[model samples]
Target: MTPTITTFTQQRVTVADGVALNVAVGGAGSPVVLLHGFPQTHLMWRHVATDLAADHTVICPDLRGYGDSDKPAATDGRTYAKRTMAADVVALARALGHDRFALAGHDRGALVAVRAGLDHPGAVTHLAALDVLPTLDMWEVMHGTSAAVGFHLYLMAQPPGLPERMIGASADAFFGHFLDGWATDPDAIPADVRAAYLKASREAVPSIVADYRASATVDVEDDQADRLAGHRLRMPVTVLQQDWGTALGFDAAARWRAWAPNLVHNTVSCGHFMAEEDPGEVVKALRGLLSR
Candidate 1:
């Protein structure tokens, strides 16, 4: 029962640096690339992509180090950095003949989308981040008891060997923890799709931890530098997030305002897996972004 979106063609597009991304292209109008988050593949967008395909050329790609994409060894934590992942998708889009495209991502993919907007302003026309804050703002807000809610972030942020070994030892438990905890309804992700995620993540332990490790170190530095230089996402940006800020005692919208000046930020009723739990809302928000 692996979910399938009909009328989509899948292919491997070798990016500029020789990383071949497994991409799914469908629909027939303006291009819009969708990036999947951790513990999932482009399959997470099954519902939304099929719906958007009516009016948009939906491009769904498994982000590097996740799903079927190339998982290069981490060299000084640079391999899995958002900047590097962002470049992969941008190159993928351009190689597919999309010079400029609407971009939407959930979780880790959202981080990449944010970086793509910041790094390649000319290429990403509209930016939508589903269920995440900027890297700097994220680290800044996770404190005290509230920080416990993001325990995995802290765990994966540790030095590479231990985190990789720990997660590898209980790969299913590790990946399944997020799958179970983050969803408002466990059934939002069908059992077959859940199995696919667990299988892919189990095989990608080292690279997966590397992605989070880079987030804590290099990603933070990059975001801090951007803030100091007053660099914000120049394109119209929409953020759909659960109200973790309220539960964690911070103003999420205000925080996003600093990074996205032309921003439309709102809280979603669904938990972290907004795309699966509430695809229609995600679609509406993305449509709003496209209109902007």
Candidate 2:
């Protein structure tokens, strides 16, 4: 029972780097681009997008390495870096006639959204990140025994080949682990949508792992450079998470405030799949960002 967006029109948008992203467009107001997280497609936004569409022109894109979007072979993880993926989103919005747009992303997409806000501050009017920390802060807090929570991050950070091969060997189990483990209500994803996620992940093992690998390496360098330059997101930013920071022994909001001067950070009781598990709260947070 995958959710459907009957009001939206779909298109294949070729970005500046020639990667064609599958995007869904709907509604009629100020533009807002929504980026879906790992192992899920733009279809993940069916609930929240439909709600936002009443007052916004919502654009949801399947990120380059996931879903039906173009999955280019990784050349040392650079291709899947959030920097590159962020550019694709900016290009997608520009191609569709928006010089600037509001942006929101969850999970891996949150990483991309953060990069987009950092790299193209002038283009992203408002930013929202769901359930993720900036790459540098993420790695900083995830150390010693705490690192075990993000074991996949370490596994994928390895030098390609082996991680891809091992994940490919049991793709369903690997993908299902996240879908099941992260969601408060596993049924929130529904069977068909879960099946779609599994299928896409199984096919894009290498590219998917490259995306994570880039977060550990190149993405960190980029974030660190920006921090050194004293750069912060200029737009109003909202971050909603499940209080992993409390469990991980870091002030999540304080950490986010370092990069987002004007930020409204809150922790939710919902699982990592906040958008699906608690669309009302997610929508409320996005609307707050939009209003700002």
Candidate 3:
């Protein structure tokens, strides 16, 4: 059986018309919503959420297109856009009685958190993004051979049909590849959690592809618009990432500084799954961000 965060209560919360999210909420005091990344579910925050729940009302939801959440068909370019996902997050928070809350996301969810911070600044009191750059900066930095590391991004960004079929063919191997390759510590995600991730990704191929495809198209357009309008994250921001910049030939902090003015950027010595690999560090960074 799949494990859940201790003491958290699970519920289905409607966040949009005809869409509801499977959410695990716990704790009291000020609210803090945690979003999980690609190939994972709210379960990714099992460690970090439990730690934060000691003092904060922790909200962990499987993004609309992942895990047990409702997966609407990608009818248009806007369907899986980070903008839509961000809105869902805001609505989720509002429904849970938080007019304002701290927010944190990992990987793909970080993209949504950044969009939320930009689109709904007043709703997000503080923001923390883990292991990702904004969509625009991500495309700008990846070039030539180095871009090969992100081949999956290009693959999922294709015009829908083919990408879905290809990934769906061997979903476990495809999704499991990242789980195995990105973690510095192989055991950070134990057998049960790894199995759960593979299971969820295996079942949500079309929506997952739609999510990534949106990043390549509409998501980038939204980021471009935000950049041109001189919009930056107004809330106190914290960014934790590996030293990908040194390998990719860009200044990671400088890249983040462009989008978030009040930022505390730290280079962590961990894999992509830092929250699981180093939950203490992730919790510490989030606590510091909230305190700001």
**Best candidate according to TM-score:** 3
In candidate 2, what are the lDDT values of residues 65-137, reduced to their tens digit?
Answer: 8887898889665798899999999999999999999999999999999999999999999999999999999
TM-score of each: 0.97, 0.97, 0.99
- Residue 120 of candidate 2: its Cα lDDT? 96
Give, for candidate 2, the lowest lDDT window spanning 10 residues.
Answer: 1-10
Query: What TM-score would you give candidate 1 relative to the actual structure?
Result: 0.97
Clash counts for the predictions, in order:
0, 0, 0
Question: Candidate 3 local accuracy as lDDT?
Answer: 0.94
Which whole-number lDDT from 0 to 100 does residue 272 have in model 2? Answer: 92
Candidate 2 residue pairs in clash (backbone atoms < 3 Å): none
21 in model 1: Cα distance from truth in Å?
0.7
Cα error of candidate 1 at position 247, Å: 1.2
Per-residue CA lDDT of candidate 3, range 1-292, in tens? Answer: 2356778999889999989999999998899999999899999999999889889999999999899999999999998999999999999999999989999999999999999999999999999999999999999998999999999999998896899998899888999999999999999999989999999889899999999999999999999999999999989999999999999999999999999999999999999999999999999999999999
lDDT of 1 by residue, 1-292 (tens): 2234567888889974657888888999999999999889899999899999999999999888887888888877778889999999899998999999999999999999999999999999999999888899999988998789788899999986888888999999989999998898898998888999999889889888999999999999999999999998999999998888888889999998988899999988888988899999999999999999
Of the two candidates 2 and 3, the one with more favorable TM-score, higher being better, is 3
The 0-to-1 C-alpha lDDT of every candidate, in the order given, reads 0.90, 0.91, 0.94
Rank ordering of all candidates by lDDT, starting from the highest: 3, 2, 1
Stretches of candidate 3 off by over 4 Å are: none
